[model samples]
Target: MAEAFKFELVSPERLLVSEEVAQVVVPGSEGQFTMLKGHAPFMTTMRPGVIEVTGQSGTVSRIFVRGGFADASPAGLTVLAEMAVPVQDLKAEQIAREIKNAEEDVADAGSDETKRVAQEKLDQLREVQAALGAPAAH
Candidate 1:
C-alpha cells in the first residue's frame, strides 16, 4: 500500500477536507506540483486551479481552489484557500460572471497596480472557464 500523508484543505467557510492521502496535486503560482509522503519542506502561494487528491483507498477527489497559501513538509500538506469547492459542484456560468467582474475591475482601476492585479485575476478566471469547457471570454 502507498504511504498515507496528512492532507488538509481549508476555506473561510469550512474545513472541506482532512484526510490521509497517497498524493495530492496542487496548483502553485509558478505551476502545478504534486506532493507525496516524505516530500521536502516548502511553501508557496497557490493560484486558481484544481487540486487533485488521491486517497489511501485509491479514490481520487478533485477540488477547485482559488488562490491561497500551501505548505508542505515530511509530515503533511496544508492548504489555506481563499475559496474552495468540489470541482463537480462548480458552475461554468458562475465562473464566467467572475470573469466579467474582473474585466470591469480592470477598466475601473485607479492605478497601474490595481489594473495589473485585476488583469491577473481575469487571466485566472479565464483559465477556470477553460477548465469548465466554457467558451473563451470575449
Candidate 2:
C-alpha cells in the first residue's frame, strides 16, 4: 500500500481540502510535479491548473487552483491558493469568461514586463481550458 500523507488545499474563500492522501499532482510554474509520502521537501509556485489528489482508498478528486505556492516538508504538503474550486463545480462558460478577461489583460498591459506577466497568465488559463476540454476562447 502507498504511504499516506497529509494534504491541505486552501483558498481565500475557505479550506477546500484537509485529508491524508496517497499522492498529489500540483501544477507548478515550471511544470506539474507529484508528491508522495517521504518525498524530498521543496516549495514551488503554482500555475493556473488542476490539482489531482489520490486518496488512500484509491478515490481521486481534482481541484482547480490559480496562483499559489505549495509547501512540502517533513510534516506534509500544503497548498495556499489564491483561488480554488472543485473541478466538478466549474462551468465551461465560467472558464471561457476568465480566458477572455485574461486576453484583455494581456492586451491592456502598459509595459513590456507587465505584458509578459499577463501573457503568462493568459497562457496558463488557456492550458486549463484545454485540460477541461472546453471550447477555445475567442
Candidate 3:
C-alpha cells in the first residue's frame, strides 16, 4: 500500500478539499514543489498555478489557486490559498474576459501608479489563465 498524508486546501469562502493523498504538487513562489508522505518540514509562498494531487485510490485531481502559502511537515501538508477552485470549474472564456478588462484598465488609468497596479493584476490573471491551459494574453 502507498503511504498517504493529510492534504487540506482552503479558500476564504470555504474549504475546497480535505483528504489523504499519496502526493501533492504545489506552485511555490520560488518554483514548483511536490510533497509526499514523511517529507521534510518547510514553509513557502505559493504562486498562481495548478495544484495537482494524486490520491491513494490512484486518482488524480487538479485545483487552480491564485496565491497562498504552504506548510509541510512529517505529519502532512496544509495549503492556505487566497483563492482556489477545482480545475473543472474554471471557465477559460471568463478568464480571457478578465484579462481583457484588466488590460483596458491599465491603459486607461490616469496615473502611473494606477497603471502599474493594473498591470500587476493583469499579470496575475494571465498566470492563472495559463495554468488552466489557456493561451496567455500578450
Candidate 4:
C-alpha cells in the first residue's frame, strides 16, 4: 500500500483541507514540486497556481492558491496560502472581470513599480483563469 502523509491546506479565511494524502503537488516560486510521505523537511515560497492533492480516500482535489508558503517534513506537509479556493468554486466571469481590472490598473499605474505590480497581478489572474479551463487571453 502507498504511504500516506498528513496534508493541510489553509487560507486566511479558513482551513480549506486537512487530511491524510498519498501525495500533493505544489506550485513553488521556483517551479512545481511534489511531496510524499517521508519527504525531507524544507520550506519554500509558493507561486500562484493550482495545488493538487491525492487523498487517502482515493479522491483528488485541486485548490487555486495565490502565493504563500509551504512547509514539508517527514511527518507531514502544511500549505499556508494567501488565498485559496476549490477549483469547482472558481467562476470564469469573475476571473475575466479581475483580468480586466488588472489590465486597467496596469494601464493607469503612474510609477514603474506600480505598473510592474499590476502586471504581476494580471499574470497571476491569467494563470488562475487557465487553470479554471478558460482559454488564454489574447
Per residue, candidate 2 scores C-alpha lDDT tens digits across 1-138 of: 589999999999888899999999999999999999998999999999999999999999999887799999988899999899899999999899888888899999999999999999999999899989988877
lDDT scores for all predictions?
0.89, 0.92, 0.86, 0.87
TM-score of each: 0.90, 0.95, 0.78, 0.82
Candidate 1 residue-wise lDDT, 37-104, digit = tens: 99999999998888999999989999988789999987799999999989888887767777888899
lDDT of model number 4: 0.87
Output the lDDT of residue 50, model 1. 88
TM-score: model 2 vs. ground truth: 0.95
Q: Write the per-residue lDDT of candidate 4 for residues 1-138, one digit (tens) a residue.
A: 459999999999999898889999999878899898999999999877899998887788988887899999877999999889887887777667768888999999999999998898788779778767876555
Model 4 TM-score is 0.82
Q: Model 3: per-residue lDDT, tens digit, 1-138?
A: 469999999899998889999999998978899899998999999867789999999899998887799999887999999888888987877677778988999989999999987887688778778656787655
- Once fitted onto the true fold, the runs of candidate 4 whose alpha carbons sit more than 4 angstroms away are 104-118, 135-138
Window of ten residues with lowest summed lDDT in model 1: 129-138
Higher-ranked by lDDT: 2 or 3: 2
* Candidate 1, lDDT over the whole model: 0.89
Native-to-model Cα distance after best TM-score fit, residue 29 in candidate 3, in Å: 0.3
